[model samples]
Target: MARRGKKKGRPISGWLVLDKPVGMGSTEAVSKIKWLFQAEKAGHAGTLDPLASGMLPIALGEATKTVPYVQDGAKVYRFTVAWGEERSTDDLEGPVTKSSDQRPAEADVLLLMPKYTGVIMQTPPQFSAIKIAGERAYDLARDGATVDIPAREVEIGRLDLIDHNADRTIFEVECGKGTYVRSLARDMGRDLGCFGHIAELRRIEVEPFTQEDFVTIAELETARFGGQGDERSDSADTVPVDFDAIDALLVDTSAALDCLPQIAISDDAATKIRLGNPVIIRGRDAPVEAEEACATARGKLVAIGAIEQGMFKPKRVFAG
Candidate 1:
């Protein structure tokens, strides 16, 4: 029998919190990062529209296992809504579908904040990634088909009025998973009797990752090519790629599990976990039961599991 061939590229793993620039899609960003790192696998925590910018946590190789944790985490967005014209996509990228001469006053915007804050049902923009009977909503919208996308519950922890003018208003929001900033602007505008759409959106925080952790594409390129400054070097054809420097940019895979409770296991337990076996969690503070927890030994991630009656049952084991 012929043996299967080995996969190409480095088996590198970890998270790369990127400062994704506007006009680049999330999948494109992940692909670019994967190519730059020459990794065997890659994925992103969440999707950020092409018009949006800021921290986009990308997972490489073994780190891809933690993507769901980051995706379900809370996110914070700062956005500006341009009033007087509602667009098909809920952003400037779409064509105008409705118009209004009325502009919301700053006082009026403030008065409506309470309505948007806390748990609310939101219908996503038509040109969105949401699926309708297995097909993407954006694809259907592009084909000139309109679908009645139902509103779903989402929680907004806080919504503050940052600034406002006759034409636009800026807001900063802290929201849970699945919340749409575009919907917030659209709904707020409709309630205020002013048509509006998202003019700008930036995600500054995604749970454990924040603005400070972000590295731009230029920086990654510079690090890989040994550029003189922070900007990407134009001499890619001449300079050799620095794999070490590029690898340094990765955040540890365990970092994504910061939200979960952790248990320190012994070498024996680590060995058992690596082989897909459960082990007794031995510690005075060992949780008798937990739905989700991470196990570590000798400062390395062993497995992600749950504590059941003092036994750590492995769910997902890490290569490291």
Candidate 2:
């Protein structure tokens, strides 16, 4: 077996997709994984609430440089919304401050689901990490200070009603990076003339990464000790885990380039772009017909350059 740090005492570099277990905060999980892998550097792409569990991309060493890329990817979640009651935290963990005398009918909820889909404005919960006046908003709220949080525009590509029970409504949501499903549920209750909060939340997917790709913490621990089974076994209980499993969960740092039309640069152009010089890009793939339109579109961390005259010059380079 090739020991991770056997060659030298230095840390190994790669990505790890942790099926973050419930209870541990995102920071805690990163710390444990870093120690287990003996990685010198590590960071998570996004924070998953301690109450929630699922895909968390842990970037190690050089991969940490790509964290920002994955942070912007679309996320999909499966959560349960409990009706007839609202809480300060907007989730089951919060204290209930209000309840309704009337129960919401299934039809009422189904009718209101469409309103949450697509682009919408959502005010984050007061008991959140969002900052206000240079301090965490939740910290202010906990100190008995009332703070008003402004609503921000977020895109919800899809919000589907998956199942419903008497008091719990199950939903699957696909939304942009910053969308808050808990706030969406709270607001949905408001729209329906009732109050509600999130009951159970589980992230089912993170754009390219899905539940199928996740590995439980127990499995990871076992893999670490070589006790649960072979570290590279092919059996269902001992399937080999590879660097790509972690890489697959990461939206390539250059994924934003996919949104734009690309031009295949000549070898000379590629070399000059790698060297860091700006060149006037023309021909197909250059910002030509839709220069303004392309500029307005969301940009990704990409390598851009072109060949002008006989010299290749580099243009803009995004974070990698």
Candidate 2 vs. true structure, TM-score: 0.75
Tens-place lDDT digits, model 1, residues 105-224: 899999999999899889988888889999999999999999779999999999998998999999999999989899888998899998899999999999998887889999887877
Which segments of candidate 1 are over 4 A away from where they belong?
1-7, 228-242
| After superposition, candidate 2 runs with Cα above 4 Å error | 1-11, 228-320
Steric clash count of candidate 1: 0
How do all models score by TM-score?
A: 0.94, 0.75
> Candidate 2 — what's its lDDT?
0.69
Q: By TM-score, how accurate is candidate 1?
A: 0.94
Evaluate all candidate structures by whole-model CA lDDT and list the values in order.
Answer: 0.90, 0.69
